[model samples]
Target: MRQHSTSTHLAQKSSWTHPIYTKKQILDVQTAHRKASSWQDRVALSTVKVLRWGMDFVTGYGTYSPISISVPKTRTMTEQKWLTRFIFLESVAGVPGMVAGMLRHLKSIRMMRRDHGWIETLLEEAYNERMHLLTFLKLAEPTWTMRCMVLGAQWVFFSGFSLAYLISPQICHRFVGYLEEEAVITYSKAIKDFDDGHLPLWEKLEAPEMAIKYWQMPENNRCMRSLLLYVRADEANHRDVNHTLGNLNQTDPNPFAAKPKIEIGLPQLQQNGRVKD
Candidate 1:
């Protein structure tokens, strides 16, 4: 029985293995904004703006300005503050994907029709965001106040997003696209802070073990800056993906449904033949 249990554990692997990123790919990631062309797009962008404003206000994060603006910066966020903001951002970010996937799954079942590859992609996105939150949790533990805030925000956002998705999935996708744009910008600023010698601790800090394994980061690129680069690239991909999804009809097939080259295989084993974490 013990041997059978051990074999079962060794066979288990993540359903959604994260994509491996090249250094060039990570570094080349840039913040992009999609223009709102229709009423749905406008409404999505507007809602994201309001939410961003509220989140920034509550987290004590200042408004972002263009890099070309030559103005003296007064506020500098500490490492802890950045972590706090990240925790909140990721906590909320993981919700939309799950809600969309769940609703589509139910609809598929009720209508006796396939979801045309959307359900898997949405669930994978949610899993990726959860990994991001776990990586940050390794860096900083949230306070009870923050926990309570996350609880309240999740409940409200989940309910609202569900209703919105039911009414119009296109708008929901556009909203998520805009939200990912903001995420890319936030991570870019953090990377800039690291580059400018502001985040001294991050300069010397290595990414969490989970992050290193998940991203398949190279030995030399396992630092905090590399982690941000990886995350920023992911947000950029998400931004583009959702914008594209927003433009498609509900019955259309997902364009980004290509399977990964690598399939789930045997777990990495230690020298003693036990599965490695």
Candidate 2:
């Protein structure tokens, strides 16, 4: 039996069974995918920001300060800066779903009524966000200070979202929807920066092993930009789902069914991944 050379294997792997794209193509698609296309879309996005601002005001001193200090300017968010942002961002991101799920579970038990599948879905969302945190853990080790910040941020956000969820789940869900919208924008910028020659570090970086496993990304096609795209798509799905829930009446059919699927095409590159747009 003839042994194949490494280049032979790699060439075979890189053969385009699917459409391959350049960095520009992926970035263009992501921007287009997340763009708010119409007047109503624009208004709704503005409203989300305003509502989130109000919510942030309630705990702004605590939550906003850490974010402001941690996340660098978009052009400056190199791998380390972005990973630091993810450490804190993901810690807080995992909170709302767990709090909402736990509260819904108790509400259902006390009322002796089924929870309309909310408990399971919310718990799943929580777990997914936790997975995001875990994936980032493989990419960056937080300093002791960053670890303390994560602990502090999680405690405050958990308390705030829990109370808000208990008082008015609509606001709680809307808050998360808005948060996810911001996440979508953040990831898109990261991808753009990397593609545009700003994040030189990305050229030398491989996608985290956990990210590849979680997204079922091709092993031969793994890069930091691909991971960002996948994670952004996840956030976009969460954004749409929570927004739909916020707009619904309690009797709405199949809330879980309303969530949008991710839909971003992955490049057939040496290190790229696919995301459901």
Candidate 3:
């Protein structure tokens, strides 16, 4: 009898390598909002606001204020509370992209037409959001209640978003754009909290090894604050990309498919040296 091989290899690479970011690029990520012009835009923005309110209430997330403003002492979030909110946010955040991508893929197959590069970007966004959730999981394990919340939220969101995407891809994309805007705000507030010495434990904490590898983070900037900066930067990009996609016709080619020259007045310095808006 031939001897059986006993060695096993571990998967060492991300399916989609995250774009590397310079410290300046990460720190420069600022919150942005796209005003609602059309009815679709209004609907999308309204939905995001309602959902944000519900999630905040359920998660006990405190309202965010500028660093210059004094936060109420009673409303302060502990490290664990922050992790709880992050976990819940990321769990739902990964839904829209996957739903949109899956629908577009099936539609393409059924109609015998190409998706014009939309599928890849949408799927990649889902993957990136999953990585965010996984990285947070490494820092804090979710309790049974949290796990239940995630399960219920994912099922409801996945179903609702799929139907919405099938009905109006533009509005769904717009909704995601607005949702990502909130994500950037949330992460920005977290970073500010860290900077203000509100999150003491995170001050000395190093990022998880998984996050460092995924973000290709630098040796010097591998702390929790840097990790939040990286995540906030990703959310900011998603905010821009989804809003742009919402503006295009369904058949239009994805502008992000090929690297462009500059993006929203910022150079995508890490990828292709620059990107277009």
Q: Which of the numbered candidates is closest to the native, going by highest TM-score? A: 3
**Model 1: per-residue Cα lDDT at residue 197:** 68
Q: For residues 1-277, could you state the per-residue lDDT of candidate 3 as single tens digits?
A: 1111213242567678887888889878999888898999999999999999998888777744664456565567767778889999999999988999999999999999988788999999999999899888878888899899899999999989988898999999989999999999999878877887778888878887778888988888888888898889999999999988887778766777755422422232224332233
lDDT of each: 0.82, 0.63, 0.83
* Residue 269 C-alpha lDDT in model 1: 17
Using Cα atoms with residue i matched to residue i, what is each candidate's TM-score against the true structure?
Answer: 0.86, 0.68, 0.88
The per-residue C-alpha lDDT of model 3 at residue 158 equals: 90
lDDT of 1 by residue, 1-277 (tens): 0011101122225778887888889989988888898899999999999999999877878533446433335445668778889999999999999999999999999999988788988998899899899888878888999999999999999999999999999999999999999999999998887787667878878887778778888999988899999988888888887887787778766766654311221221122232221
Order of quality (TM-score): 3, 1, 2
Cα lDDT of model 2 overall?
0.63
User: Which segments of candidate 2 are over 4 A away from where they belong?
Assistant: 1-75, 257-277
The model with the greatest lDDT is: 3
Name the better of 2 and 3 by lDDT. Answer: 3
Q: What ranges in model 1 sit over 4 Å off?
A: 1-12, 63-75, 259-277
